[model samples]
Target: MTSTEQAVETFDSLDPTTDEVVGTYPVHGPDAVAAAVGRARGAAEWWASLGFAGRAERLRRWKGVIVRRMAELCDVVSAETGKPKGDAQLEVVLAVEHIEWAARNARKVLGPKRRPSGLLLANQAATVEYQPLGVVGVIGPWNYPVFTPLGSVAYALAAGNAVVFKPSEYTPGVGAWLVRAFEEVVPERPVLQLVTGFGATGAALVRSDVDKIAFTGSAATGKKIMAAAAERLTPVVIEAGGKDPLLVDADADLDAAVDAAVWGAFSNAGQTCVGVERVYVHTAVYDEFVAKLTERARQVRPGEHYGPMTMRSQLDVVRRHIADALARGGRALVGGADAVGERYVRPTVLVDVPEDSAAVREETFGPTITVTRVSDMDEAVEKANDSTYGLGSTVFSRRRGMELARRLRTGMTAINAPLSFAGVAALPFGGVGESGFGRIHGPEGLREFARPKAITRQRYRMPLVMTTFARTPKTDELVRRLVTVLHGRR
Candidate 1:
């Protein structure tokens, strides 16, 4: 096929329900991605030369553009991903907040600071400062298209780096809208660039000469990105998949637990990386908790509550998870195989699913949750931390919420709430193990895009010289005597 025909024949973003093509985007290849990165390198210099104050002003102007044109951006998101306009608006608003915070706080968080050189280097005055990487390549997820990508993009820009963003194939138009808005604010250079395609395009971006890469996607894909980055020794920040859990204690507020579970499990059709996928309830209130969850689940009707699954291929995965749970002697009290609709999966709540089942262990990125009864808080913590993924988690308890939250080996935990850690812009957002590494959203986010530079200046020459072409036995003996005097067996 001709290049034009080949490009046209590539997959198009479709309306999930009607299966009609909603938009056509170029399936960017290696050449296109390389060219974009090349342009971004030049942009980085211009952006960095603006200094912190100038960049902050430009960022505020960009924020105004996004706030004023929120509806237009949401419309593009809705058309491309089939998510509700309200949900799209919510993501965009959070994204704008992040952009504003990054712009305002980057200098303070990343500016130079003094540090003690310790007695070993007593004659030196040590200092540390964060320097921006030249260019950053961000591969974002379709879910929360704006918020997730901007979590990286905004911080990178604030740190004085140019960004080349590759939004998910399912939400390329949303990515385009953001890039266009940013260009208007910094029209002197291509400070923000966009490339749209599938996995191949993403692979191209990872292998490019960008100084750093920020990826938000499945853990499986995160591994691939990390491995590819290793080729160029490129630093990366990965916000991968999560099988997050919400624990309930015997003395917990049943109403709060139920509310958190409902919203955490079913919101955005359960496509969130930090969404609750497992619930470990204290056996004392297991039955009561399950009943409350079921009632709340019923109240959340799929169509009015959320839109269709953005990726059509995810339908089979959702169906398989439910079927596997049932075949393994699990019961779906609220929704079963029949709940898997053509485009949207109705909220499914399963009980008695084996802990080893895919529905429990794997990331079933659908509107399905598995609830299990645990003997006590100990068992709850163990099961919650047993997963390969350790992103964010939630705990609902009156007396032991903080203790239990600390025990779980995840990055961040919300007490009496679901995914609240993400809403708090001051806290860091990331995970350990399979959930991925690196953080975003706060001071940690600002430093991720920067490299630490250590500076030391000699205040004066010490009597005991350590780094000159001259050495004396008396000086060595004095140094040993001083060490013994300070830290000897007292």
Candidate 2:
């Protein structure tokens, strides 16, 4: 059979709200993934040769294209992901900002700079710079597809790496739209490409010869991707799932805290990786907070502040969690077992939930939150910290916001707001433990897709050299004396 005939398999992208066929894309298999990576390898050389300035110009042009056609992109995002157009617009705007920031600041962040040679190597000149990692394979998530993937894509391109993106099956059209816009700005080379399909296709990308992989998805899928990449010893940045928590302090503004909790738990149907899945309130404010939270949560029906669960299978998970919560003596203060619909999940709030319940321990990627009361701030912090996933958290306290935020074991924290850390282009985003590792966004993100290269130049030949065998005895004695003088005292 001809290669074209063999590669004719395709999949339809559907709208979660109506189950309508939004678009279709090829089910690119291993052979296609490999070919894409090979093309990216050659493209990486040409892209890198463009240097920081050339890439930045192209990226800036790409940003202009995105801004000029923002409405069209938001439409695609909204249609494919079932998110509100406003929410989609907000994500795209953040993505444009990230692209601009990466292009504007790549040189300052990754360019070569002189470094002190230290006391031992006073006669040597030293420098360090970050070089591109050739080709990067980005496996994006359906939730916040544009904003989440651009967190890596823009920075990777700005740092001089070619990207082979494999967006989620649910949002391939959005990915195709982004690549189409980027190609208009950079038509010279295949700097950015797309391969669309399901988990097998993503597995193919992970096992391919890409220099690095940036993945954003569930922790189970993240582990599988990491293991697949390990076969080639390829580096990976895994942005996995999170059962994030929010702490309500005794001094927090009750109205503000209630608003944050409602928005944080119900936005995007609570499918956010950094979404508030659990809440720990000080006993002093537990009753008041729960009452207000329940009222606000009831106002948050599906199709208003949030949309349907993009992945249909997620509906079952949501049902299971709520059922488990109710069966285990948990009281549903808002929408409960009946809240989960065929596509949309009504906002549900559970209180007095056991800490070990699936609703609390696992990521309930739905419009639901578990609120547990604690005796004091210490107990609140302890309960919030007792989780395997440490992705993002929130603390609502006028005075102790930062203090409580610091105490939570999370990558990013929003003090008085809901998921505000993601909008800031300068703060790093990632998680620890089960939430995964490697940062995206800010300076750390720009460096994530690049490898540091260090250079040392000897200004002049020195008689007291320790790296060569020309004169070892005197050099060894001098090195020992210097080490003792410098570090021994400390």
Candidate 3:
């Protein structure tokens, strides 16, 4: 059979709300993935040679194209993910900002910088810089398809690497749209390429001859990717699941806290990895907080406010969590066990849930939250930190917001707000523990896809001659004396 005939397998991307096929794409297998990577190798060399200024200029042009065609891309995102145009645009906007940031800041973050040569090597000049890692394989997730994946993709591109992206099968059209837009600005080579398929395609990308891998999904999937990449000794960045929490203190603005909780929990059908999944309110205002949260949650309709669960199978997980919570003596203030529908899940606010319950311990990835009342800020912090996943958290305290936020065992935190850290272009973003490892924003992200290169120059010959065999007994005694003088006191 010809190559086209051999690659005849295809799949349909469906609208989450309607279950209608939005688009059909080929199921790219190992051969296709390897071919894409091989093409990227040449692209990587050419892209890196462009240097920071040349790449930034092209990236800026790409941003303009994205902005000009924002509505069209948003439509595609909405079609596949079933999110409202507004929600889709929000992620797109964040993605554009990230692209801009990565392009503008790559030089400052990865450029060579002079390093201080210690007294022992006073005649030597030293500097360090980060260089591109050739080709990068990005396996994106369906939820927040634009914002989450671009967190790594844009940074990798700015660091002068060619990208072979394998977006989630659920949103292949969105992925294709982004690649096309990039090509319009960068017609010289295939700097960004898209391969659409299921999990097998992603596995192939991981095993291919890529320099590094950046994956965003469940912890189980992240572990599998890590194991596969280990065979090639390829470095990876995993942005896995999160069971984030929000704390409401006695002095916090009740109205603001309620609004944040509602938006964070119900927005995007609560599929956000950093969305507020749990809330801990001080006993002083627990009753009032619950009343307001329930009232606000009731006003959030799935289709109008957010959309249906993008992946149909996610509905089962949401259903199971709510059922287990209810069965374990938990009560739903708004939508209960019946909240989960065929396509959409009604906004559900659960209370009196056991701390060890699945709904609290695991990432629900749905528009549901558990509100637990605590006696004081201490209990609030303790309970909030009682999870294996430590990704993001929010603290709503007028007087001690910063203090509490600092104490939380999370990678990122917001004071008196919700999901604020994600919107900023300068702050580093990632999580520890089960939530995943490595960062994807700020200077750290630019360096994640690049290898650090250190350079040293001999300004003059040192009297001691420490690094050569020409050193004599006098030189050894001098080195020992210098070390003793420099470090012995401490």
Clash counts per candidate, in order, are 0, 0, 0
lDDT of 1 by residue, 145-192 (tens): 899999999999999999999999888888888999988988889989
Steric clash pairs (candidate 1): none
Best by lDDT: 3
Better of 1 and 3 by lDDT: 3
* Residue-level error in angstroms, candidate 1, position 455: 0.4
Stretch of 10 with least lDDT, candidate 2: 463-472
Identify the superior model by lDDT, candidate 1 or candidate 2.
Answer: 2
Off by over 4 Å in 2: 1-7, 472-490
Score each candidate by Cα lDDT.
Answer: 0.91, 0.93, 0.94
- By TM-score, is 2 or 3 better? 3
How accurate locally is residue 410 in candidate 3, as Cα lDDT from 0 to 100? Answer: 92
Q: What is the lDDT of residue 148 in candidate 1?
A: 93
All models, RMSD in angstroms: 2.0, 1.7, 1.3
Candidate 3's C-alpha runs over 4 A off are 1-7
